[model samples]
Target: MSTTKTCVRSPVPTIALCFIVALFEGLDVQSAGIAGPAIAAHFGLSSSMMGAVFSASIIGLLPGALAGGWLADRLGRKRVLIVAVMIFGVFSAATAMVWSFESLLIMRFLTGVGLGAAMPNLIALASEAVEQRSHGQAVSFMYCGLPLGGALAVLISNAGLEGSWKAVFYVGGLGPLLIVPLLCLWLPESSAYRAQKGRDHSAPTRRLRVLFQQAAARPTLLLWVSYFFTLMVLYILQNWLPSLMMSQGLVRSEVGTVQVALNLGGAIGSLLMGLLMDRWRIMALIVSMYLGTVAALAGLGFSSQFYSMVVAAFAAGFFSIGSQLVLYALAPRFYPTSIRGTGVGSALAVGRLGSICGPLVAGQMLATGSGAAMVLMAATPGIVVAAAAMLLLVAGQHRNQR
Candidate 1:
């Protein structure tokens, strides 16, 4: 597609709308973790059972991302995104009304489907809406909403809501539902997607096949590896951090403080990485990011003092969440507009697998008598693998550019 026809005249409105969707997504994603303890107690759930609850949404995410991306290629980013937002919104609100463990799992799984589907569209729209040179910043800016919304979820959790854990869901659900109208009025379909739609004559199977053909195969595999390991670490932190901190001697209020710090750091890290992604040396930045992640994980493991844990949480959020944002920005560049949603979605779907594993592994480890430090340290090797995969992916992209 021609650059002029591919990109919108102004990306702000599209990116802004996508940001709103992502904000709610972040809230819903973190809501399960924020509300975990109360829900576990209310339902009398064991650690393994609670891990199942955490994995339910992620399991739904795998298919949701796959189908959502496929539909976006056929239907359109805006249409698919709207339906996704609605599905998650209704289900998230329904989460508060669940009367049993099964119902809670059902509601959360449906919410995960919506969240999964919406993410690739957000990345696709944000990247396609802007000039190629600005893709990194555009997607990063939109993605920062996720961590900021997580911060918002933390605040709501602590906001004296009569001890009702359902309050976070109500806010997370209603915000997305309310934003649908705004999206209808303001969000534009990706110009690139529109241009390619009529020309995309390949069948769905063919599109899937292309992901593994010749040069595409390596990056696709590497991206999946990077996503899987990185997300495993991230989801572990997101879902288990509060309980883990409490187990390590922090109070509820202090854990809440660390959660806020973690999220705030995520928001800042996303924007910071966005600015540097397009300008900095790729390999060096990748090294630094992963190294920081390792240090943060160690800090979270060893730090028993309240203030030290808070600092560690911030660093953890900064590098771990920030690395994911960087990956999101990079994914769009590997595929053209026609299959961009599919490519990104497939990557995200694979990442959700790690997401599912993270919480489950943490739960099992804790249930089996692993310490918080042991659980935290277990993630280091995966970080090393993710960093290596990303470096190779970047090297390939540079070679292609040459």
Candidate 2:
């Protein structure tokens, strides 16, 4: 394995830049959802069509992640990231200018590609920036920008765009473009990548095949299972939580409050859990997070009172979202610099499939007359499976070290 320490002495600047990019990525990711009603009104989209519109970017994310990581491995993280920002930024602005439904779909799909491509690089760069001991904290700190950025999107939406949804797209688009110069001026390439490149200029042969070799097959499969189920739970909540709340007779305002609580809890969880993973017992921390996640899900499913629901939502975000951070932090450690981007990106690409599946499955279950509690209960078995996989991965890593 290439050295975890990089040529760059200070990790602060790298992490800070990655955080800015993630914040914008989060904004763009959530912008479509926030502005969905206005977009539907403008385009006269049917419910099915609007669903397609929402899924357009998500569908684009899978290929984008695969391609972005591949390019980052070959071309360099800094360059690929700039291009990704430009792709998403320009296309996001184009979304505002779109005149037809087809045009809007095209714009959003391209924007999704950009957003998808940027994430792997973000994970790779952030992980490489710090020492191995601080990898979890660094990656977690970078991830905090995601939920915080979502909060920023919410704030912009609430600022009242006068039903002009284009305004949201414009802000999401321009913010990243404005940051391009800063990235070019200040963002450092991963020295880990640089060192690996120095040793072997030849392109990685059969990168996918490499991930399964060298005793990597087990961890890689386990990581995919963890990522898939974890993200499934996350997207299920993100897309369906409001409906679940309303099903219990909560008002729109109360639902909004619960949503805010979820995001705030996610931001805190990402930051705090990352720090904790660095300092606390790894197995204990992982076990606690998964247990908290299961409990939170039950809380969301069973709680009828508003205050109890709020507390449940917060815990859900804290643990469920924190579980994602743990996976991201753990992923980079499984592969060397050569295949790290591919490994992480591939796992994320698979996870995106879960994200897409999550809401659909929840909707189907609801359509079959299942209540929120039932839906939440259905997820418990999957959570247990994900928890077990992670625990095994952590145990394997500890054994290897010993």
Best by lDDT: 1
lDDT of 2 by residue, 114-190 (tens): 99899999999999998898898899989988877766766776665675578778888999999999999999999
Stretches > 4 Å off in candidate 2: 1-8, 36-51, 97-104, 198-205, 246-252, 367-369
Cα lDDT computed for each candidate against the true fold: 0.92, 0.84
How high is each candidate's TM-score? Answer: 0.97, 0.90
Off by over 4 Å in 1: 1-8
The TM-score between candidate 1 and the true structure equals: 0.97
lDDT of 2 at 360: 63
